[model samples]
Target: MGEFEFLAKLRERLPPDGPQVKLGSGDDAAVTAPAGATATSVDAIVEGVHFRRGEAELRTVGRKALATALSDLAAMGAEAGEAYVVLGAPADLGEEDFLALLDGMLELAAETGTTIAGGDVTRAPALTLAVTVVGHAAAADAFVTRAGAQPGDLLVLTGEIGAAAAGRLLLEHPALAAELPESTARELRRRQLDPMPRLRTGLALAGSGATAMIDLSDGLAADAGHLARAGGVALQIQADSLPLAAGVAEVAAAAGRDPIELAVAGGEDYELLAALPPDRLVPASDASGEAGEAKLTPIGEVVVGEGVEIRLPRGGQLKAAGFDHFAGPERGSQPEARERRGG
Candidate 1:
């Protein structure tokens, strides 16, 4: 199909526009009316660098491309509004594959109550998806940022970690799944392929007096560093206090890697991490469970220092590798692209 023909197909399949959107899709620019404030973020995933098309369904890839981008808005405690997608399709992509990809994003957009407002399509050497998302809030101050953390604030994380990293390991070395239960193995892979953004949890925390917040996209250790640096305070995370996904230890052990390291440095959990006042813990936890079905775990504290320190239970510091997009290749880093290879 031609580009315009494909776009027409997309318009037919897209969900109805959200409340904020005045004009959506098939226009030179999308029209949105906002009452207060807006938060925007963009993310892109490539065929080999971010995912292997051979291993993942086109629908899953579409979901992930949109999910990860929305995660940034979630960190800011913004309500999902609308999405603009830029899709680069290689010549070989069939019509069914293209629609499959769009269907995935449509599914997630409907679930999040977000509208697919507008986007552009083009030819490329690889399958590429870039998503721009805008979220809504009552006011600018109503949304949380990483710089708002204060000393003596408690550090809390929504949902567990290390599952995506373990999932990556299983994908790279399928033999590791032998020791884990079938369901556990399936869940680990799902965590890597279809991570859910903690949107409701973020909204609850923001309303519950959260001072600072971020999504765990680049692993806890690296993302915590970002939070600490932005807030100009030190973070002391207890190694033993981290909530690991059910099969992380098994997958890590079978792969001859440290479970804690995987949990700390394994990227793409897509969970929210926030700094909260001590008094807000109960309300935050209660609200988070009620809104998102996620439990808030107090993992650490902000202190009068700089950088992040992961304190081991036995009185030592644990070193973990963190994902960096522009850095040189390193083991356990760049979970999204660690196993990247051309099709």
Candidate 2:
């Protein structure tokens, strides 16, 4: 049976009066008590697909797995509350390692003020983690979607991009990685292993007249396309204006890769990409007290077109193309793989 079918069977086995189950499992659907402006999101992590087995610590893996889902909540301008986690682990995982994974998840939950209210565990051939987070927004309309950008809007991004991608390349090529400074390598490693959601930035933009916005989980090129399509407008990204994290150029040069390509096509930064009205592009410091540390940089403009186009600093406009899941046999390319990694 498929995973969904299996989950349905498990839900059927639950007793009717199972603890505070205002919403039980099974049937065509189930209902939960109406929450205040409820916001929900789900994410899944697989062993070979998301991370290499034995390459990451149990705690770090667990923390990253949960943080992935929370990133979505933050993008929606939601305040995280509780989460449900489901695990599928191979028989080879030791009992202590399994416990450590749970402990790691709990650590992140405590830090984020979220609770692990419920979940399930099962045996599988590979290790997998899936999470569903439920949060609430004070007002439903306060949430941001990708469909409101307009012509003349200024594109702004929070934090720097490409660090996680650089870190991944380092993990695969230790010799080249050695060329990077110790501090740069450490920071890149942290970004890859544990990403912070742009919760405050997203919310701040939502309140600051952002026309459209999306979380930069996928590569900037790919996610920009999503926003453009949703908004029925064209997004023009300036290649020269991209904000690159410190040491990104050194790391990319060592790997013989293009730093701009890494910034455009690498995924999982978990920063916010927003389009704000031109006149309203006030510095982030003017909006929030902590903005000085995470400066917002304007890198593009929304235009009257149907899709995304990147204007290179040196030459012509290039179509914005990154990763797609159903691109068939043409899916193994570097950009495509990076895009698929986001989902």
Candidate 3:
């Protein structure tokens, strides 16, 4: 179908605008009335660099594009609000493909009470999606930041890590699926293709006195470094304490890699990692449990130092490296100097 025709279909499929949105799509700009504070983030995924369209359904891709972008809002402990999307369609796309993708995104928007306020479509060399999400909070201080971690604060993590990375490995090397149960392999693939943002848990942590927070899109090792750099502190993570998904070890072993390294260096888990006061640990865990979100686990602590140090249970330290967006297929680590400092 043509661009205008697809847009008309999108408008027809969208649900009623949320309370925060004054005007929805089909305008030059979307109008929104913020209650108090707002946190905005933008993220994009490209076909080859982010995903191989051949391996995933268009619907799943749509969900992932929006979910990944909203993860930023979750990290800030903000309530999801509105989303603006930009879809770049390749020449081979058809009407059914477009609607299927929109249906996926609309489903997620409804689930999160987010309004699809505005967007644009264009021809591109590859299938591309860019999503911009705005999240709301009572005040600026209500939203946690990476820069707010304090010395002696306890580091907490939501859900488990390495599943998405393992999922990617499975997708890229289908032969490795023989190493895991069928269900486990499918779940791992789902983890990579359709990650959910930790919205409720983020709000719970924010309410429970979390001082600093970030989502694990770029693996624990790299993102922990980001938090440490932002807060000007050190993150001492116990390797044994990391919560690994059930099939991560199997997949890692089959792939001839360390499960801990996969958990540390793998990206796209989309779970929340936060720094909370010692006294707030129980409250935070309870809050997350009451919300029926992922289990909260204490994996480390913040100290008065500069880099991130992931201590292995046996000995030595884990050299963590996360996904590099611009680094082609052979993604490398950050500079030695910055990595040494844990940034």
Candidate 4:
């Protein structure tokens, strides 16, 4: 049977009602009535698709897998509580490696104040890690969404973009990664392996005049497009102003790739992008300050137009297009095309 079918059959065998399962199975993740407002998110990480087998450490892989699901919770302005894990591993993997993976996940969960309440394990041809996290918000309405953006809103991004993609490129080409200083390389690698969800920022911005918001899982251009399409407004990203971590330019130069393209189209940054009213821009900084790093940067503005576009400082506009997971393997694997700056 297919994955969904297998899961459905397993879920059907559960008892009709239980204290721990206020709402269970079939949804994104099971829910239990916590003390506060509730939210849930799930993420699945595959071996070949999400990570290379030998290239990544077991603990790091587990932490990253859990972090991916937690990002969804951050987007919903939720504070993490409990996590349930389901893992599928190949028969050939050693017991030590399996335990290391769990240890890694547990370490991160503890650090983030999330508990590992329960889990399931099974054997498969390839390794897959799936985590479902439950969290509580202070209020039910304290969640941001892509539907709230309006014309004339300012667009903002948190943290630097393209570091993860750059790190991936370095991992695939060690010679290029070695060209940079050890610290820079380490930071980029860390960004790729351990993405920090903007949980505090999302919580602060929710109901505080955020017009619309989304996490940058899929490149900025792609995620911005999602927000634009959902809100029925055009977004114009300022290419020149995108923040990049140190050594990004050097790495981009060595790889013969446009740093702007990487910044715009590279995925997995996990930073939050928000649309805010002009007056609310002040509070954006306030929200970011609570995070201590001041990760927010105003990158663009929402305006009247047909589709999303990127404005380069030089003299033109670049079309808004990035990775689309559902568009099939061919579309996702290809490098994004670079178009002239303006329509």
- Per TM-score, the best of the predicted structures is 1
Residue 115 lDDT (model 2): 60
Q: If ranked by lDDT, best first, what sequence of candidates would result?
A: 1, 3, 2, 4
Candidate 4 worst ten-residue window by lDDT: 334-343
Q: For candidate 2, lDDT tens digit of each residue in 59-121?
A: 888898888998888767667766788889787876666766777777787777666666777
lDDT at residue 122 of model 4 (Cα atoms): 78
- Give the alpha carbon lDDT tens digit for every residue of 55-169 in model 3: 8888988898899999999999999999999999999999989988899999888888789999999999998899999999999889999999999999999999989888888
Q: Measured by TM-score, how close is model 4 to the native structure?
A: 0.85
Angstrom error at residue 233, model 2: 0.5
* Residue 125 alpha-carbon offset, candidate 2, angstroms: 1.3
Model 1 Cα lDDT, one tens digit per residue, 122-229: 999999999999999999999999999999999999999989989888888899999999999999999899988888888999999999999988789889999999
Of candidate 2, the 10-residue stretch with the lowest lDDT total is 12-21
- lDDT by residue (83-156, candidate 4, tens digit) is 78898978777766776777777777766777665567677888988898887876776667688788899988
Alpha-carbon runs more than 4 Å astray in model 4: 1-31, 326-343
| lDDT value for model 2 | 0.74
Per-candidate local distance difference test? 0.89, 0.74, 0.89, 0.74
In model 2, which residue pairs have backbone atoms overlapping below 3 Å? Answer: none
Q: Give the TM-scores of the predictions, in the order they appear.
A: 0.96, 0.85, 0.95, 0.85
